[model samples]
Target: MSDSSINLDELRQRIDQLDGDILRLISERAACAQKVAHVKLAHDKDAVFYRPEREAQVLRRIMSLNEGPLDSEEMARLFREIMSACLALEQPIKVAYLGPEGTFTQQAALKHFGESAISLPMAAIDEVFREVEAGAVNYGVVPVENSTEGVVNHTLDTFMDSSIHICGEVVLRIHHHLLISDTTRRDKISRIYSHPQSFGQCRKWLDAHYPHAERVPVSSNAEAAKLVKTEWHSAAIAGDMAAKLYGLERVADKIEDRPDNSTRFLIIGSHQVPMAGEDKTSIVVAMRNQPGALHDLLEPFHRHKIDLTRIETRPSRTGVWNYVFFIDFKGHVDEPRVAAVLDEVRLRASELRVLGSYPQGVL
Candidate 1:
């Protein structure tokens, strides 16, 4: 045999041996996870099988320890799947996300929780909250904000009325594509369908290419993709998940105006997550409708040097011209400095509710 062929054969044999070792180790890990479930169940009948903080820590550690041809994130993602599978052996988790099965929120849910999770789709953001609030699902995922389109006000408004807590968060980079079905007449495409935000993201691209095409706003990009499947003269602007789900072909890929377009999704649940070293806390503050109310609200955070990640204002339902502020900042509430800041802010604001203090996104 040639030297190159012999080398390739030896490499293949080494890989096969490594695969066997990996399989055995994974089995051992699964057995250990099963034992953990038994121990927890033995002590507490209703013990929670999933720990967001713990999972976050593991993924973060895996990323930190990785030194290979594969990047840290890619390595962490592999570990995340392994952890998810082992957790399923302990107890399967149910998650709800805003969807008709193929939206970005669904993608975010799958990214945050692995494929082992049972994911349900809700028609509206409020419905996602309701599912988690009613205990129908273990957790819910909802889009909080987009890098280009700003905040998802519907999600913020739903949070105002719901008692659900934020468990964790995941950020997904969005890439909208112009998609068509097999029957679509490429040249005869007279209408385009997409969510309003998607149209905004891809406005420049559409204007430059298909300016004459009627831009039809729909409930979601998934719905747009679904509509295109039946329309011969229509195309949809949506993400890869929607296109794949509807079996549509991409006519134009990554047509979003900005290359850095992304969306942040929140994982909502009943339980408060413990600190995972690096953490972020979300709170909603209702200030008295008076001069310097906003100043009073933000002074504590600034004074404490707490890094604020996001701050958004929504009209309050209580009174005229009243506004509630949704604030996200670094540090867990269990810490002395963070607790001090919250205490000070509570004294100044009319109402302050800490939504959650969870580990920042690991992947």
Candidate 2:
């Protein structure tokens, strides 16, 4: 045999052996998870199948221990799926996301919960919050902010009236593609469909290229992708999942004006999550309408030297709400420094509500 042929044969043999070994290990892990399920069932009839803090710790450890040809994030994703399957052996988790199916929120849901999870799509952000609040689903995922477009106000506004807690977070890097169905007239495209935020992110690009095209804002990129499937003169701006789900072709890829466009999605549930070492706490403070109200609200955080990730102000929904500040900061609520800051803020604010402290996004 030729030298190259011999090397190829050996490599194939080695890969086959490794595949078998991996299969065995995965089966063993699933078996162990099943054993865990039985033990929990014996102790508590309503044992939660998933633990946000525990999952975060595992993913972080996987990334930390990785010294691989595969990137840390990539390796962590593989383990994510593995864990998801094992968790299904314990119990399948039902999650709701804002969507008509095939939206970026759905992608974030799948990424965080894995394919083994049962993900349901809701029409709006409030619906996602409502689902978890009603106990219709075990958890919900909703977009909180986009790197290119700032905060999602609707999500923040929902927190003011809802009791659902933030249990975890997931960040999805967005890459918008101009997609068209097989029957779409590429040359006759006069209208482009996409979510408003997707259009906003790609404004410069749109103006430079298809400036004359009518930009129509829809409920979601998935809905946009769905609409174009029957329209001959329209193209949809959406992501890869939508494109595949609807059998569309990419007319242009990664057309977002910002290359690093990403959206942060929060996991909402009925229960508060314990600290996962690295954590973030979200709170809404209704400030008294007075001088230095803004400054007074932030002073405690600065004094404690706590890292603030984001701060957004929304018009209060209640009669008492003149201005409500939504704050996200580093450190779990259980920590002394965070507790001290909250105590100070509580004294200054008319009202305060801790949304939930959750593990920081790991993958």
Candidate 3:
């Protein structure tokens, strides 16, 4: 029998009771987190820390175990916010990202900490790194690479000198939309604005649709969206969030050249997170550019049975003729095998920098 066939008052009472139980459980979970913080502090340990591997595993587990209409991402976000609040209660953390406000990095900051943590916006990527380095922000988010456009060289080059660790990684699905100010006159747009990545991703689409429009590069998509609202002859290629925030008209949706285009962002912090099953370790290795040097360094991983995920070469800042290979693999430094691989790599390379490892973001 359904609620309509039963006594309405009794059915309402049952739902109310269920809600009470849910509230009680939420309270219990929060209390337990506080206790965990207390226990860690008692042991003279750091209570507040970001564990990317743990987060990735948690979200993945939640997705695997999901049995409802809410979807895995929905459930993961709900729990993520709760964990963020609990950690903030233990100790509030401040994060800095490239922004004036309402930027994609800000969205990344929210993804990392939910609504509980505070976020500070810096004008440039270097500033984001500097703020984190200076202890002005506990963490920072910056785009490392795009699926379509390749690696962000600035971020890669910045790592050569900074001591920040890569605590997590978030892969964001990117969608570009053409937003126009309502006041825009004439169907012929004189200018288009967006972040360079957005512009590049949507290049073909724009070339075909609006060949004569002046494509202008801006610092961020949000800034581009803001600019469109003020310029009657201009349109912005930005995400849904930017379009909505600026109250611009979404003339076209998913206007990027490819649907699978995504950006990989890195979470930079000062501590190494413990392994939580699935994790990624990033490190920069400088080896002799000789025939067997690369082979020697990579052979140890195969010997140790480690799965290397990504390997990229960047010109070494020490000299124009030299280069460093940055690698990402699916294992934590704490694992004996992983540790052994690193030890072996250290002996083979002239210089090695562990970029730190953390749980991967499931998104």
Candidate 4:
């Protein structure tokens, strides 16, 4: 064999040896973690199997120990699975997402839960919260904000009365596409259907191309895709997944106003999530409509060096146009700095509700 070929073979052999060693080490580590779970349970008299603190420590240690030819982010993600598996050795997780399946919420659900979860799809945002509240699901995924348009009002409003806490979050890139039935006639298109959100995301593209086509709003992107199947003259604006799931052909893709348009989703559950060094908290504060009310509510956060990630105004629902500002910020609610900010804000606002504190969503 050529010298270079012989060298390649030797490298492959080494990689195979390393892979086996890594697997063996992971299995041993899992056994050790399970033992830790038992010890924690005995001491705490609660479920010690899922220690968010230990999970965070494991991930941080993995990053610290990594001398990676692989990216640190990639290494951490792989280790997240290891911790997830170890945790599951103690308990398997059940997650809920907003969907009829093929919805963006499902994408966020997968991102948050990894592959080791039982994911249930719900028909409405409130239904997702209901499932979590009812203990029918362990975690619920729902949209909270969109970069292009604004907050998902339904999700924010659900927060108004719901008692379920936000446990984690995920952000998903929103992509819009124009899809049609296989038999659709390109020249005879009359009306288009999509969820209002999807239509809003693709508004500029639609106006410039199909200025005369009637735009109709449906309950969801999937429903719009389903509508197109019954009528050959109508096309649906949805994501690639919807098109694929409905067996529709895409005539247009990436049609959103901007390429970076994305939505932030929240994972809601009953438990208060432990601090994962990098975390975020969401709170809803209702202030009496006074001049500089927002400033007064935000002042404490600024003083505490808490970073505000999002702020959206919604009708207070107690009265029309008496708006409440929904604010999301960095740092877990359990942290001292964040707790202080909330305490101060609570004193200033008429009403203060902690939506939840959770780990910041990663792409």
Give the root-mean-square deviation of each candidate in angstroms: 0.8, 1.3, 2.5, 2.9
Candidate 3, residue 46: Cα displacement in angstroms equals 6.8
**Pairs in clash, predicted candidate 4:** none
Q: Sort the candidates on lDDT, descending order.
A: 2, 1, 3, 4
Q: lDDT of each prediction vs. the true structure? A: 0.94, 0.94, 0.86, 0.83
Tens-digit per-residue lDDT, 1-363, candidate 4:
899999999999999999999999999988997787788777887563544444555666777888979877688778777767776776677888888777778767766666676788888999998998998877889998888988888998998989999877677889888899988898889999988888888888999999999999988888889899999799999887788889999888889998999988887888887887888888888998889988898888888888898888888888877988888899987788788888898889999998877666544
Evaluate model 1: give its TM-score: 0.99
Query: Quick one: best TM-score, which candidate?
Result: 1
What lDDT score goes with residue 149 in model 4? Answer: 86
RMSD of 4: 2.9
Displacement of the residue 45 alpha carbon in candidate 1, Å? 1.3
Sort all candidates by TM-score, best to worst: 1, 2, 3, 4
lDDT of model 2, residue 309 = 92
Compared with the true structure, model 2 gives a TM-score of 0.97
lDDT comparing candidate 3 with the true structure: 0.86
Q: By summed lDDT, which 10 consecutive residues of candidate 1 come out lowest? A: 60-69
> What lDDT is reached at residue 316 by model 2?
84
